[model samples]
Target chain A: MPPRKPASKDPEPLPRSARKDLTRAKLLQAALTLMGEGRSFTSLGLREIAREAGLVPNAFYRHFRNTDELGLVLVEDVGITLRRLLREARKMDVAPRDMLRRSVSVYLEYVKLNRLQFLFISSERSGGSRILRLAIRNDVTHFTNEMAQDFRIRGLYAQLPTASLQMVCGMIVMTMLAAATDVLDLPPDQPLLEAEMSENFVQQLKIILFGATRLNDALTRS
Target chain B: MPPRKPASKDPEPLPRSARKDLTRAKLLQAALTLMGEGRSFTSLGLREIAREAGLVPNAFYRHFRNTDELGLVLVEDVGITLRRLLREARKMDVAPRDMLRRSVSVYLEYVKLNRLQFLFISSERSGGSRILRLAIRNDVTHFTNEMAQDFRIRGLYAQLPTASLQMVCGMIVMTMLAAATDVLDLPPDQPLLEAEMSENFVQQLKIILFGATRLNDALTRS
Candidate 1:
């Protein structure tokens, strides 16, 4: 099969297409929630997702070419969701520490809400349909590039090259990926709530940010 | 179907049992190699893994109840491997920084040699297998407890409790996992060659250690 195309835009949204898009969105949303509950996209069937969305199995094809294609959509959805959270969270005039605390909460909440999608994206690097994997890598690259721009704009990473910024972003994202999952048995649904898990996250962020900031400090000291 | 039990201990290591255990180990080893190639565990099948191990499909059942069960075993194996690496690495008579650098190199080399198992464990939790997910969590707890004991014996974590030490271990494992998996896409297997990745790892460790040390120092000064 030809590589599945991402949802295309039309100058004017057709009701039929809009409905299909809505159905697709709903399926993705349901999948994300299911993932949060610990379902894998590989094992998740299109029929089950459609059933969750209260649609017939045939209706799923109207949106996604197949389940693997839907997984790509889900991966893209996670990127969009996370970016949206970052954007909205950025609007708050809080200290970086406070913002990070809030961000952790928001991040966990996103995982809880879209568990399946978050897990799906998290696991994408491992065995998955080829198309889905590429989409995930694309999302990672896009997000990294986006963050470089954000950090540059804020002057936080003004001295760093895009590569270093990407490394920092990669580290942060990877740490968060570990945090977002229950692999650590953190003794809390959201580690941000547990004093221990939350403190660890705070310190982990501090260590990462400190390392980034200090790299600049070292360069200046030299 | 009932959950599969791992192999039993025997003095002589029965021919069939030993053979089953070796096949499982071989499959895991094969998975690790495949992981370096960027394949996730979910995308792989039993037949392929068994075939890779020069065994027939039915022979796989003698080892694992299913691929997910095999994934759980892989997680356990990774924890053991990592803990062994830390133990062996720490025994080297060198500067802490140099020791750490070499440790990372060893880690990368190990992953390069055992790609499938590492990738399987890394991808398991997010891949939505209950057994694998729980196994990863349990192994993490096991690792944290081990780290906490080591820290206590060395009196290294006086400033932090065992819980906090475990969290630190969790964060370090997260960073290591990220580094090992090529999640950063460091020029496609370039993390091993790039002095920067190991340098960053050491720097991050220093920041964690010294940052906490300095916090205590500052408190004393204040």
Candidate 2:
């Protein structure tokens, strides 16, 4: 075989814009990695994050004005990522029961695969950053609104008040988040333990769903 | 008016043990105050805490070996305070519906009254301290176990498996904690807003209880 032409030299060196984007992504991932080790974003230093990203401290400013700014961006990214996955799960053409099971499975898988992102989210949900906390709360409210709309579309609780629907959706979201935190907090080597937690989480979710449906029926009839 | 003997010159100085206890309480309260301001325990310095408590840095060692030790003590204290309040609420003689309404009200009121303690617990939950996180988790588990026993005694969900009961208890606890955090995170001047949030929280709890009861009946029938 020919020598492959030295992989085309620089392979058309990345454009300035793309290079900037790459650096920003690297910085965000580095922060995520540090946060995943249990340090809150407030405790994390800008220099440390820049070092972790293999960039100088000054380069950090090219992406974010400060750590809080970076944290806000991370919060937005996590919110978008989570909402997109859940929305896709809701879009699947499956039976209601299977949809729920699949949705939860996907969510847990995402939490496991994006350990750093989820860790950043869970920690910051009530961590030291006020802006991040509010950002998460807004995302939760937005997610709840989206879930309420999906339920309305499906006619799952057609007679229930909109507020009631929001309440139910909020509970489900909070439960799923709590479960994700619990699973991630477990020792990484404990696959068996993690599986058990996953099963328990599903059971808990089923119980809540069963209860919510029954309540909706009762309310409509009364 | 009598001079009252100038209030006695000695004034019966506090006993040594009482003085020690007061100092410990002061230190803990200082930590709580700092954590309440959106700072995680891991971000807190011993000297800062000591200063807040109006003591020298070296004096902090008299109460705790290090910040983690102080944090562990704080976790235990918070757990005890929470468990006691919940136990008292559970002991009230009222209908099931009233019981839940009253319990949540009491819980929220406690959160308001002990804002600092709740803030500490909320922050440390997923904070950087592994030991503190585990301590909180164990307290939660213990609290759930106690609730399960109480449910059994009350003839609630009598036919459900213990694990299922635990799941229910865990959900309730998580919901209450989330609610507490929400209330505390709100601006201090929002009385009207706080009341509205309280009402919404009550409604959400009612829905969960309604669903749990229906599930219990169904499980019994099946």
> Chain B vs. true chain B: TM-score for each candidate?
0.72, 0.88
Q: For every candidate, what share of the true interface contacts is present?
A: 0.36, 0.67
Question: What TM-score does prediction 2 earn?
Answer: 0.91
Stretches of candidate 1 off by over 4 Å are: A1-14, A33-37, A51-59, A94-103, A106-116, A125-127, A157-162, A182-195, B1-39, B43-64, B94-97, B151-158, B183-203, B216-222
Number of the top lDDT candidate = 2
| Native interface contacts retained, candidate 2 | 0.67
- Every model's DockQ: 0.33, 0.59
lDDT of 1 by residue, A70-153 (tens): 777677677887688668656764466577777776666666676555656766654466677668878776776676677777
Clash totals in order: 14, 1
Candidate 1 global TM-score: 0.76
Model 2 chain B: weakest 10-residue lDDT segment is B93-102
Residue A161 local lDDT, model 1 = 65
Candidate 2, residues B150-178: lDDT per residue as tens digits? 88988988987888888888888888888
Model 2 residue pairs with clashes: A211-B211
> How would you encode candidate 2's per-residue C-alpha lDDT over A1-222 as one tens digit per residue?
658567658665788999899999999989988877666677899999999999999999999999999989998898888787767767684586566667677788888887887788788788777788889778878888888898898888787889888888888888888888987888887889887888878877776677678768888889
Output DockQ, candidate 1. 0.33
